[model samples]
Target: MGITHRGTTRRVRAALSAAVVICAVTAAVPAAATAAANATDAVRGPTVAVGGLDVGVERISVATDEGYGAASITPDGRSVVFRSLKDVAGSGGNEVYVHDRSAGRTRTEPIVEGWTPAISGDGRQVAATTPAQGMSTQRIRQHSLDLGILPFGCGRCNEPSLSADGRHLAFGVVDYISHNRRVLVADRDGGYQTIAYLGSGAPARPSISGDGRHVAYQDRAYQKEGVYLWDRTTGTTSGPLEGPDTYASLVQLSDDGGKVVYLSGSDTYVHDVASGTTQRVPDVKGVAIDPTGRHLLYAPHGTGGPSLVLRDLRTGTDKTVSDQPATAEVDSVSADGRDVVFQSAADGIVPGDTNGKPDVFVRRLF
Candidate 1:
C-alpha cells in the first residue's frame, strides 16, 4: 500500500523521507504528455536497462506534465491503484487508475474525483477520499474494480484505509469546532466504532490489519505524541511508544497487525504488538511492509546515490533495489517483497524515459 499523510489528499512533491534521510531525492519536475485517460491498453513502456541482472523493471505511468502522483499495490501484487493528473475522457483533474499486471491492462476507476487511494489485499476493492462538495467535511467512498461503487457511509472522514479482506474500512475524523479528532473502523455491514480519540490534534493515518482487529494510528494529544495500536478483540490501546522525540506517525501495519512501522524524530521504528518490543531502523526512511512484516522497503542514502533498499527485519540484511543516480520514492512493495512500485524523475531507470518527469516504475527483484 502507498503511504499517504493524514489530512492530505494529494501527493506532495517533496519527499517524505527527506526530513531524516540524507540521500532522499529532490522534488520531481513536471512534464506534459497526452495519453488516453480511459485507455485499457496494455501498459508497455521502456524495458529494463540492459543488464544481466535477474530483475525486471517496468514503467506503469505515462510521462505526463502533471504534478506529483502516488501509487499503491495490493497484497497479491497483481494490481496497482494510483492517482494521476493524466487527462481523462471528460475529467480535467486528478484521476484514479487501476493497473492489472496479470491482465496487462490499465483502466480508470468509476469515480475519478478521489485521491489517497487504498487497495484491498485481493485487489478487488479500493477506498479513496473526496472533498464533500459545498460542505466543509470530506467523504470516503469505496469502489469495486469489477462492480461500480460499494456502500460506504464515511461522512466527514479522510485518510481512508482498508483491511486486507476489504471487509473493514478505517479513517480519521476531525471535529473542527471542538478540535478533537478520532479514528474509526467501519465494517461492510455499516457498523463502526471509534478506536482512538484525541482531545486536540489529528490522529492521522489509520492502518488496519487484514482481519480488521487491529488499528495503528498517529496520536498527537497533549504530552503524548507517538504511534498507538488499538486491538478490537482485547479492547485495549497500547503505548505512546516513545520515539526519538515526542512526534511519531504510523508508516505501515503488518497484515496480522502484530507489527507497526512508524516514524519519529526523523527515524523509523517497528513495534511488535505481541512482544512489546521496538526495533529502530537506523538511517533509513521506512515505506511499506510486506504481508509477513519481516521485510521493509525503505530509502537509504548509498554511495551510488539515493536508492530504495529492502531490509530484512530478522537478519539486518539490505538489498539495493532501485540503484539509480537520482533518488526514488518507495511507493508500495509486494507481499513477498519481490515487486516494488516507486516514482522517480531520474533518467535511464528505463530506456526512453526522456520526458524529464517523474514516472511510476515497478522493479521485480525476484
Candidate 2:
C-alpha cells in the first residue's frame, strides 16, 4: 500500500449564505434542543491530524479506453459494482459491471446492460436502468438486471438504489403526464409499492435503508421541496427533514434509518432520528454515513484542494486519508465507512497511478 502526505490546512468560517431553519421532530424522534438563530452560521472547520492518516490504496479496475467509473462496494467489502463504457468500435455508450475480489484481476463481469447500477449488500442482486428492448425509440427501463422485472407507467426509471439485504429497491419514475411523477420501492419477488407521489414537483432520488423498512427521498409534492422518510409498515410518508429556506438534500442514512445526513445550501447536517437533533458538520461536502451511524466519510472543501476525509461522529476527530492534495470527487463508500471509493486525477495518492485519465481508487481506512 502507498501512503502520501498533504500539507494543506483546513479552514471554515461562520455565516454561510444559505437560509437557516429550526430542526423539526417527527414520527418516532423526540425533539432535542433547537439551534440558536445564526448558530448555523457559527460552523467550525473539521479537526485534521498531522501528516494525514495512512490508508491502503488499491486499483479495482484495469485501465481501459472504454472507461470504468461510478463504482459501488458492497457493505461486506468483497464485491464492487461499477460503470464501464463499451469498447465496441463506433459505439458511444456504457454499462454496469460487477467485480468480485475473489476473482482476482480477471476483469469485471457485465451484470446488466444499463446505467446507474446499484447492488444489494451481499452483492447477489443488482438493479439498473436498462434500455427498453423492442421500443420504437431509445427508452430506459428499470430491472433487477437479471430476471423477473415488471413494467411501469411512462416507460422510464433511473437512479436505482438497493437495500443492504438486497430484498428491496427504491427508484424514481418519470411519467409522461404532469405531476404524475412518483417514487417507488419494490421487492425482488414482490411487485412495486408506491411510497410517495408527486402531483406538482418532479420526483427526486429515493433510497432504502439497510433493513428495507424505511425510505429517504426528496419530495416535491409538498409546497416546498423537502427530504422525507416513508414508513413501510404504515404505508404512509411523514417526517420531512426540516432546514433553512435552503432545502435540505438528504445524502445518506444510517443502517437502521435512524439517522440522516443532508446538505442545506453549502452547509451539511446530521439528524438523529431517535433524538430529532441536527448536528452541523462544518465544511464537509458530499457527506455519507456509515452503517453504525458513528462514523462519516466526506470530501473536505478548501483552497488546499479536495482531500478524502473521515470524521468520527462520536469523538469529533478528523483524519485525512490522502496525503496528496489533488482534486478528488467522492463516488461511493462502504457501509462501515472503512472503504472509501473516489475518483481523482492527482499523481501523489499512489505511485504508478500515472494513468492520467480520471481513474477510480479505493482507500481502505482499516
For all predicted structures, in order, the TM-scores are 0.80, 0.74
**Full-model lDDT for every candidate:** 0.66, 0.57
Global CA lDDT computed for model 1: 0.66
Q: What does candidate 2's lDDT look like per residue over 1-366, in tens digits? A: 000011111121212122211111121211231111011111111332435743477665555333556676767666666665544333334555555554443223333444557767666555666555443212333333223233433356666777876666677766655636677776655356767666654647676788888777776665546677766765556556646663767676666677777777667787776676778887667556666677777777675744767778889887666655433321266666777665556655555655565555667776
Model 2 accuracy (lDDT, Cα): 0.57
- What are the RMSDs of all candidates, in order? 10.5, 15.8
Q: Where does candidate 1 clash, by residue pair?
A: 31-64, 31-65, 32-65
- The regions of model 2 sitting more than 4 angstroms off are 1-55, 64-66, 85-92, 105-115, 133-154, 200-203, 323-331
Candidate 1 local lDDT, 325-345, one digit each (tens)? 433322287876777787777
What's the C-alpha lDDT at position 189 in model 1?
52
Best-matching candidate per lDDT: 1
